[model samples]
Target: MGNITGFMEHQKVPLHYRDPMERIKDWNEIATLPTEEILREQASRCMDCAVPFCQDGTQLAGMTTGCPVYNLIPEWNDLVYKGRWKEAYHRLSRTNPFPEFTGRACPAPCEGGCVATLATDSVTIKNIERAIIDKAFEEGWVQPNIPKHRTGKKVAVIGSGPAGLACASVLNQHGHQVTVYERADRIGGLLTYGIPKTKIEQYVVDRRIRLMEEEGIAFVTNTEVGKQLQMDQLHSENDAVILCIGSTRPRDLNIPGRNQKGIHFAMDYLHQNTKSLLDSNFADEEFINAEGKDVIVIGGGDTATDCVTTAVRQNCKSLVQFDIYPIRPTKRAEDNPWPQYPVIHKVDTGQEEAKHVFGNDPRAFATTAQGFTSDKYGNITGVKSVNIKTKFNEKGEKIRDIVPGTEKIWSAQLVLLAIGFSGPETGLIKQTKVALNNQSNIKVKKDTFQTDEEGIFAAGDARTGASLIVWAIQEGKEAAMECHHYLMRNVS
Candidate 1:
């Protein structure tokens, strides 16, 4: 428990983000960390509640609430309040393997499920968690935790994303020789490529990678599992094979002019941008440049917002984002209540930046692109869109009715499709012949996460389709436990 009266005395402190104008000029972190003094006070807002749901995350009405990694939010908050930064970091590390990544990128369902939120704004759990880890790194408390003993077993982890990295880290700590295989040229899969530098910097990722290397985890980049390295090689060489390839097959728009040259999936754009930035600081011109063009983002999810932010930083001449769904209420609707993740309107960093630069929010709610317009040479010129109303039919089926007069043309030279992903790619799945669920993701047995193929397991998006980073980390840890038990059966 923190100071008994601290919750009442201190209101939640807002995050201090760099001015939009200033941030758009460069690619540095947009949010500035408040001083330790300020963070300590913010940590005090963890009220002593009868039921601290902040630490216990679960799905409510199909939405995530609280810490998916099951972080000891209250315990760490109390420690931070007592100025026990190192202890706080240790407590945080007990549940979450990568607090640095979650602290910066996670949406913090803990805040939404905070008991304090029932009466007022929730405690700044995410910020406090990040502060502890950041402070730990600064004081050199974070070092390689290399296991002294070896199991003489090997686990090959495919993909370098959060799930794969988490799995590899835990398995390495378990003293199994772990070699993480990544298809990309660099380590840190989604952490490096999928996530933008504006969110989690490359240095943060590189630092963790270096520590993992120090801790005896072998990383092989630019190596895909079933292609460059044969499928049987992993099976014959390792005790277990873990698939964390992620749900990379993007869901695309198959509408008119879909073949336009300027249109690209959100992930491809983000990956190239980050890689270009890291590889040569954008000097290579490998990324899809949005500078001085009318950019239309064709989705309204987090990925779409990322596209918006990236375009803003790239100095797009004008921008528009389309959200197929209706605008959420500023306050939670009647169907939405406390402790459950509130589906309220949130203005994320991307929208904030776009609004600051464009004189208004860029989102066009209840709208979707009907087709693309193209110039003579086939480069995109604009998009044809229509606004619609969504309603539930008698059978509880949702339907979207186009509003007749709302069809319009949006001028654009660049179109980014941030619609979402379908599932993991078919190449590895076909080569491995892993059974798939109805959703096209790898079919995993309940709890065990083992595929139909013995000694082969799946976790993260590859198993569950697209999901949160926090969830992916949790799955990776759990899969590691199950994988460890399976491997031990063969150890003797």
Candidate 2:
């Protein structure tokens, strides 16, 4: 343990971000890396306990509590504290192949499960991890994992998202020729389009893509497997196929006056902005322009928050968010004990940016959209909102119950729905002859990621539902192992 009393002596240094007012002017990343001294002090606070719950990497109370990829948090903490960054990178890469991605985007469940958090705040494991990798890239320590020999076996990964990348990365290291196919023009599916640029910059993703290409992994973008390239052709050409296509079908809010012009899906809005920004820095003006409009974002999740930030940058006239659920407790409740992910209030960057410009918090808690109020041209002019309260149904299931006489209309020119995704789109997937469960997710064996058909497998959000990036990565690595075993069965 580096300084046995460090946890008691040092207070947790919070993650730093660019100024809200200043950052809203550009699409650059909001976070700012801490100095080496500050990061080392934060690393010192890890405690290095005999049983480090921070690395447990399991679910508690139906929520992720720790690093899902089973990161070696304590060991890396000690290494960072002692100026052993290269060694720290080695240990960090042992479990997580791409710390840079997780470090920037992950929610840091590891901090919630830390032993130190029982008394004090947890260590800044996420920031330290990002630092280790960033330093590794700066020092030329990060490199391609080119295999010594090829097995002459070809594997086709039908998504370029995190899960697909992780699976393809492992297979490539195992001497298998891995080819990742992305429908979008870009290599990263969600990382490139679904996530906003303010969180993860494009250059970071591009840098990793370049390295993976150097490792002999072939990436085919702008060409879908089932459409441009037929599934029969993919099956006939490749030895095996793996589907990492993520949960993509956005859930819709089918309410009165729903077919209005101004209302749009959150991902659609975000995707247009990013594609335009990357294409011509938004000069082409081919994207949705929220300028001089009262924007109302619906649903309460990361996607909703992302919509808020995106609108703020577009110079919206006014902003407000509608969350159906009530505001979460500022502190953990009695039932939410230690070692569980704390469900509490958080002022995300989007909210902070809106407040900086609007002079107040823009969230309306315990509220939901009853319907839309449109103008003569069928454009959304306002939202008919009603206050809601959580109630238990006859089957003891939670349901939203409307409060009487609490219905009101709020002015809005733009409405973005961020309710969340339902499941993966099955149009192209069904062509592979793989069976899907009732939830529209690809069905796999209990342990293996193999689908109903031989030599066909699935993983990540396509197999599960829409989930955290860390969980998708974990599934990808494990799925790759099973696939490798299947491929080598006939060998010596």
Candidate 3:
């Protein structure tokens, strides 16, 4: 540790968001960067713990305890404290290939496991990480790591999302020719379109994609493998095929009036907005206009929060989010002890902005949407909702029972379903004839990434269901290693 008593001397310095009124007017990132000196002070606060659980990457109580990528937290913190910005970036890049992405979007379970959090405020690890990577780019420290020699091996990475990108990056670094295929017009799968530009600027994603191209990785956009290119053709061309196709089939709300107009899936709404924003800077044709409409978002996750914030930016008349589950406790319960990821309430940036724009918080816990009411043209006009309580049956199965006489109608011109995804779409899996798990995810070996089909492997969200970017990166890296080894051994 650079400063042993640094934790005692400095309190945690939190990142400040731009004023809601000013930031909501545009799609730029709401966060303002801290100065180098202030960032150094924040990094210095990393205590020299005997056991650094911040990077332990353990699963406790079915939640991630620390960084899934196992970032060298203490080492980089010390480097930043000594003003070794380049060294700090290198240390961070050693584990996470894209710190800028994680630094911006990751929920950062690392801070929850920080030793300092036990008695005092935890280190601003995510902010410091962002500072390191952003500095590396500013100072021209980041460059292409082109391999001197080629291994004469070709690998095909399906989907250019976080997992696919990570796998392609690693395989390319190992001197193998890697080609990434994306079904969308852009390179990044979710990072490019699903996420709003307000969270991570498109240029940040573009910068990394440009670097990867410079490093000799080929990217084919608007190319769907199973449809445009046959699976057998891909198998014949590439030595190995790694499927990082993310779980993107959104969970639908199956109720009466689901087919009504003006009701859309969250991703469809978000994707259209980002695409239009980039195409013409939000001018031209409107994309899912929420202006002056009472919007109802169904779910209580990050995607749902994104919907809330996006609607606010569009100047929606009113916003309300419904969660079937109860609100979490403000503080960690006794069962969630130290080193365990706390299951407590948190107000994300979007939620905070929503509160600022609307006079109150927009979340309604233990609430379920019963059905929808429509106008003469069949466009949704209102939502029928009821508050519900959970009860355990004789077999110990939890069930939700609607409270009698609690049904109410709320005005809603637009309904966005933000419920989580079930698993990866089965089109490619069916075309390729790969086995799937009970949950519809690609089934790989217990400790390997190899699918039942030869020369095909699955990783990331496609195999593990929807998860954090860090976990997806880890899966991609591990799958790359296994794929590389298989390629080396099976050389004809």
List CA RMSD, all candidates: 1.1, 1.1, 1.6
Q: lDDT (CA) for every model shown?
A: 0.90, 0.92, 0.91
lDDT of 2 by residue, 283-368 (tens): 99989889999999998899999999999999999999999889999999998998899888999999999999999888999999
* Model 3, span 1-492: residue lDDT tens: 989889999988898899988888999999877888899899889989998889868778678879989999999999999999999999999999999999988888899899998878889998988888999999999999998889999999999999999999999999999999999989998998888888899999999999999999999998999899888899999999999999999999888888889899999999988888998988866589899999999999889998988999999999999988888898878978888887888887777878888988899889999899998899999999999998889997889998999898989999999999999988888877688899988999888999999899999999999988889988899999999999999566
Those runs of model 2 whose alpha carbons end farther than 4 Å from true positions after fitting are 393-396
Give lDDT: candidate 2, residue 184: 93
- Per-residue lDDT for 1-492 in model 1, tens only? 858667888988977899888888888778777898989899888888888999887999788998888898888898999999989988988999899999998988999999998788998888888889999999999999989999998999998889999999999998999999999999988888888888888899999999999999999988887799998878889989999889999998989999989999999999999889988999999999999999999898889999998999999999999999999999988889988888889899999999999999999999989999998999999999999999999997989999999999999999999998999997887777579899999998875689999889999999988999999999899999899999898566
Model 3 score (lDDT): 0.91
Against the true structure, whose lDDT is highest?
2
Q: List the residue pairs that clash in candidate 2.
A: none
Candidate 2: lDDT of 202? 98
Those runs of model 3 whose alpha carbons end farther than 4 Å from true positions after fitting are 391-398
